[model samples]
Target: MANVAISELDKNCGKVVAEIVKLERKIFPKHESLASFFENELKKKNSGLLYLHVDGELAGYVMYSWPSSLYASITKLAVKEQWRRQGHGEVLLKAAIEKCRTRKVSCIMLHVDPLRTPALNLYKKHGFQVDCLVESYYSSDRNAYRMYLDFDSS
Candidate 1:
């Protein structure tokens, strides 16, 4: 397994953005707004894009936004097919969680497709709990589990 390096993306990240767009097409074929969405995120102070490079190659990325003081939302996360089980996703997720923690957010939340067992398992193993099921959350044909991790234990 190659060593993975995580980096915060910026406007000058054309090559990384291109790679992300390519992977987005493969991972979420129906989502055509990713390029623009990521670009906009690069310009937002409250939003972030983090990419993981394995052996100098783009392996995966995670995007998130701090919508409010109370919680941060994970907007998207994906690891290339070849890098799926090599701990890249967990690294990216942990990075995102740390980013949120720095902002003093009380909780971190994300929506995952119910059909994606591996992703669901990853989040669960990382201490996330399913908050509820949202029908047609992703689209009219897909449902989602709204999962959250609370930093404040009561």
Candidate 2:
């Protein structure tokens, strides 16, 4: 638990990609194309990818996908295992929410593993509520819990 800073992730996209791969392997252990898609879209202004730096090192990352006319989707959010419970997740999440507010987006959504109780609780604490259950959503056939947060104009 050190000084943590989050900024738009670009130069660190590759590291973020690797961290996700690490998570994937720890869980169902499969490679997917979503990581590459996010990396490519980072060069565009309408899209954003957030990274966390703590104690002067890249500790975690998160991202929101803005595709033309869709509600910005939280594509990924991962903090290295050693850095968990240090509040970096909440920091990145608030950053993402603020990013949406700045863009005038009214709703933000994300998908989380239904079995990850801690993560589900974390999102709930931040005002994200379950929207739906995406059954067999991943290559590993793991269920995904879709969550949404509505931003108020006032």
Candidate 3:
């Protein structure tokens, strides 16, 4: 595995935005985050982005938001297909979790497609529990598990 570095994306970096869009399209062909929404998120004080770089390439990223003091929500997490199984996703996830802790959020929440077993297992390993089932959460054909990691407990 190549050494990976984590960096917070700067809102002013247009190049980073373009790279992110490209990666999103490849990783999430049907559910790509809109460029306008992504750009808007970059400008938000309560939102954050973490990028995992392997030898100067974008290996993965996590985008999250602290909409309120009570909870932090992970909007997206993706690792390049080539980077899967190398722990890049967890690295980005841990960084995002730490960022939430810094803001003193009570819990971190995320939704994952139920069919995505690998992702479900990853969240479970990180202390996230299924809070509920969100029917058609992602789209009409997809359902989701609403998982949460509470900071109040160990």
Q: Clashes in candidate 3: how many?
A: 0
Ranking by TM-score: 3, 1, 2
Instruction: Assess each prediction's global lDDT (C-alpha) against the native.
Output: 0.88, 0.73, 0.88
Which ranges in model 1 have alpha carbons more than 4 Å from their true place? none
Report backbone clashes per prediction: 0, 0, 0
Estimate the lDDT of model 2.
0.73
Among these predicted structures, which one has the highest lDDT? 1
| RMSD of each predicted structure | 1.6, 3.2, 1.3
1-154 in candidate 3: lDDT tens per residue?
A: 5767999988577887789878887778456455546787778999999988898898889999999999999989999999898888888888999998999999999999989998999999999999999998878888899999999994
The best candidate in terms of TM-score? 3
Pairs clashing in candidate 1?
A: none
1 or 2: which has the higher TM-score? 1
TM for every model, in the order presented, reads 0.93, 0.80, 0.95
Where does model 3 exceed 4 Å of error? none
Tens digits of per-residue lDDT for model 1 on 1-154?
A: 5676899997788988989988887888565347656566667789998999999999999999998999999988999999898789999999999998899999999999889999999999989999999998877888999999999961
Candidates ranked, most accurate by lDDT first? 1, 3, 2
